[model samples]
Target: MKKIRKSKTEQLNFGNYSFEVIKKKIKNIYFRVYPSKGKIIVSAPFSIDSETLNKAILSKSDWLNKQVKKAAIAKPEPVKTYITGEKLLFKGEIYSLYVDYRHTGPRVAKTFDKVIHLKVKPGTDFPQREKIIISWYRKELKRSIGMYIDKWQPRIGVTVNEFNVRKMKTRWGSCNVNAKRIWLNLALIKCAEKFLEYVIVHEMIHLLERKHNARFKSLMDRFIPDWKRLKKELNRFSL
Candidate 1:
């Protein structure tokens, strides 16, 4: 039987580029670049020495430089103020918002021509209004997540114990394989429904394979043939 090496992480600096290197029991080295901040991460096998790793990184300097340049000039999304006539993203579609101050509980509804109607009590402040919209997003996302779980659990042949939604800064979703629980990012509600489903399926797959290895990629291909594309598209959105 083959033994797996325990993974360890360390920081490496090469001139202007710094990388977070994780030495794991893996066959090949992998590089990931975060376009938003030009962060680079390298996953290398435990057997690789620092000299070899440095050489490998140097070979990819051109590609890394291009990615960092793009990040330097990247434009960030505008901050939302949750006001009337402001465009909001939901299910990958943008909708113009209409705020209605009524003597009623906070409610949100969608009407014709891609418009979202948000009804709140009179004298509601900005934070209050934002809270109301967030509450509505959570409710709708939960409802849809329940339906997707029901639909995919049978096909995937995995029984999830439970799932939760919350605001996550880094990850779209995560699965606790032993507990059979999944956590989805609350921000997913703003993207397309397909993106949400992709995240769900990705987390569920972790129940079967804990690591993102060849076996995991094979399983993803079997389930979501275009998952590579979906993943690329989904990452284009900020957390």
Candidate 2:
């Protein structure tokens, strides 16, 4: 078995723009721009030298500008202060935030009335409060992901060594075939359960077929007949 190398990352600056360059065991270079945050990420093969990569990226300057301009058309939402009255997204529904002061450690819970109660010690700062909520999201997401993985493993005729949840701006999920691990985005917690299931199944199918070719589509079609509609709806949300 070929051991996967830890991808090397560096910052690349060209003119007025900066890119997060990541070199991985990939065949081709891929550029992804997150318009909501104006973040640019470049993934290239390790065999390619920086000079060639720079030239390739520089050549796409025009395309990058167009994407940036298109993104500018939509106004970005204001930054969240993680205070009361702010909306919290959970399971594809918006909930009003309710902060509860307590002598106990920080925690998060949702009420029957669509309110997310964030319980924290008195005088907990914004960063700490945000961290608490994120921690809660991670735990909840992991539990849900486990349920899906267990439910699909036998059906798909594959087993996963492990799965992880993280904040990803570009992709919802990724599969490390060699590691038998799948990474689910923390953002998926905000989407509907069906959308989350769609992503999970999509990544699981990668174990059978690494590339997204006809065989992959056939597997997806057999497993999720309406995945195309789910994918369309899921993309409407910002990562």
Q: In model 1, which runs have C-alpha deviations exceeding 4 angstroms? A: 1-75
| Candidate 2 weakest lDDT stretch, 10 residues | 69-78
Q: Report clash pairs, candidate 2.
A: none
**TM-score of each candidate structure, all chains considered together:** 0.68, 0.68
lDDT of 2 by residue, 1-239 (tens): 99878799988898778898899989999988877667789999989987899899889999998655434433233577789999777876678898999998677889999999998899999999989898998999999999999999999999999999999988999999999999999988877799999999999999999998999999999999999998876776677
Clashing residue pair totals per candidate (backbone < 3 A): 0, 0
Candidate closest to the true structure, highest lDDT? 2
List residue ranges in candidate 2 displaced over 4 A.
1-77
